[model samples]
Target: MTLLGDLLADLDAEAAELRSVVAGLDADTWATPTPAPGWSIATQVAHLAWTDERAALAAAARTPAGREAWDAEVARALTDPASYVDDGAHELARLDPTELLAHWDAARAALGEALCAHPSSERMPWYGPPMTPASMATARLMETWAHGLDVHDALGARPAPTDRIRHVAHLGVRTRDHAFTVRGETPPAEPFRVQLEGPSGAMWTWGPADAAQRVSGPAYDFCLLSTQRAHRDDTALVATGPDAQRWLEIAQAFAGPPGPGREPAGCADARSPHG
Candidate 1:
């Protein structure tokens, strides 16, 4: 399979897992608050559907006008800034739980088709910089996995970790410099080594074998850190150098403004599953 094909497959798998987790939810379960501040289980799925629809529209646009329309919508969303994601999610959440799930199913299917049709070398416009089809798909997978965790945690269930986390881990490593740039800091001139143990017991390493700075941890914790789902103090990840430690604090594999990450494990209302 092509790289893009592989990414799409992984995304489908992740989406499927999430669907299964939420398939039999009762009304009370759907209304349960998740780790995300002011977001319920239904809100989590609604946000995913909204994002998938937007990504599909972006991927399907093949003309300047088509792209411009999507860009205009994105600009409008930015105007609201704080409420962009929440507004869309709340609007969609107004639907019945079953309707919301159906919407997500259709949106995810359309997104997969759109991504498959787009040329691998072409860049698709996003909220931040344009991304290759592979990158977009990987981002979608990361979001699904992260949000799914919120749903699971809200239900007080812990799903077993899987090797699919390798994609998120790789994305985290690749976005090391972007993490620094977003915070108005310069990335270290020398690359930092990332050595993580995958769920399957395989070692996944990035950067040089003997770099001065290094990050070492379980792949699951790394993914949580990269997604800002877990605060550095809550994770078992170890950073050897100052740069590496700083990166841990601000790591974000997804695009957009820096997230207000959840507080460390037990401070007030800090409710992250990973925490």
Candidate 2:
């Protein structure tokens, strides 16, 4: 399989993992709140479905009869960057668990088809900068995993970590510049080396071997931190230089503004033993 094909498969696997948990939930359980403020498991799934729908729209816009919807998304994102996403999630969350799950399943399938049918050389429009097919697939996977964590936490369920998070860890390393850029700060000219041990204890490394600034630790911890699902204090990942340390402090794999990261232990719930 091609890189995009592999990424798409992993994306589907990640979604399936989340679906396995949510599928068993009754309507009342779907209403159970997650860690994210004002979002339930239903809301999380709703957000995923909406995002997937937009992803498909963006892909389809590369062809005829699709540009209008994609243009509207761009307009909404420009006019109300923050509230639009929350509003979509809130509105979709009103659906029953069954309907929401079915919607998510359908949306994701449509996203896959659109991505495959679209021209590979052409970048797709999005709320943020355009994305290549692989990046889009990885972003979707990263989101599915991150939101799955919220559902897991709400249900007190512990799902085992998998090597599929390498996509997220890769995005984390790739977005080091975007991290600083979002804060209106300049990204360092020199790259930082990152070495993470995967779920099965295999090491994954990126950047130059001799880079002065570096981050090293369990891929699980790095993934959590990159997604802003865990605070630096909560992760055992080590940063070797000021730049590397600062990157961990502000790392964000998803697009948009810097996120309000999880608070350290004592300030809030630890959401412990996530690895």
Candidate 3:
């Protein structure tokens, strides 16, 4: 399969896994607060629904008006950028739990179809830089997996790691420069080697094999760090050079503004091992 095909398949599988977790939840469980500050289980799914719908619309909009509409929507989102996601979730929360699930199911299906049908080379407008179909699909998979973590944590369940995380890990590695640029820092001219232990016990690598700088660890921890779901100090990932360390400190796999990463596992200072 092509890159786009692989990404699309991964997106669908991730979404299905998330849906299975939520499918059996009761109303009370749906309202349970997740690891994400101020977001409930329902809110997480709602946000995914909203994003998928927007992605589908963006892909379908080829005209000037259509593009302008998306731009306007993004501008509105930027107005209260911090609360933008929560606000959208609140709107969707007005619906019944089952209704929200149905909406997400439909939106996710539409997004998968729209993305598969789109030209792989044409860029689709997003809140950040425009993304090609492959990038968009990979982004969706990343989001799905990230939010899936929220849902699982809320339910006190630990989902098993899968090889699918290779996609997210790859994105994390590729976004090394974006992570720096977002923070107004200059990225290193020399690439850093990333050596991760994949789910199936395979080594996944990027950059030079014998580079001076290197990041080495379990792929799962790297994904969490890249997505800001886990603090750097909390993870087992090791950085061998200045650039590699800085990358771990501010790495981000998702688009848009830099995220306020999670507080250190249980400490006031993120740098402190313990509070």
Better of 2 and 3 by lDDT: 2
RMSD of each: 2.2, 2.5, 3.4
In candidate 2, which residue ranges exceed 4 Å CA deviation?
76-79, 269-275
For each candidate in turn, the TM-score is 0.93, 0.95, 0.91
Q: What is the lDDT of residue 163 in candidate 1?
A: 91
Sort all candidates by TM-score, best to worst. Answer: 2, 1, 3
Global CA lDDT computed for model 1: 0.86
Error of 2 at 13 (Å): 0.7
lDDT of each: 0.86, 0.88, 0.85
- List model 1 lDDT by residue over 22-64, tens digit each: 8898878888999887889998999999999999989976778
Model with the higher TM-score, candidate 1 or 2: 2
Candidate 2 lDDT trough over 10 residues, lowest sum? 266-275
Error of 1 at 155 (Å): 0.6
Models ranked on lDDT:
2, 1, 3
Please, what are the lDDT tens digits per residue for candidate 3 over residues 1-275?
99988888888899999998898888888899887767788888898898898898777656788778877888898899877766877799667888998999899888878787778899998876888888888888888899898788779886899999999999999999999998899999998999999989999999999899999999999998888878898899999998899899999998766888878777653321000
| Model 2: lDDT of residue 121 | 71
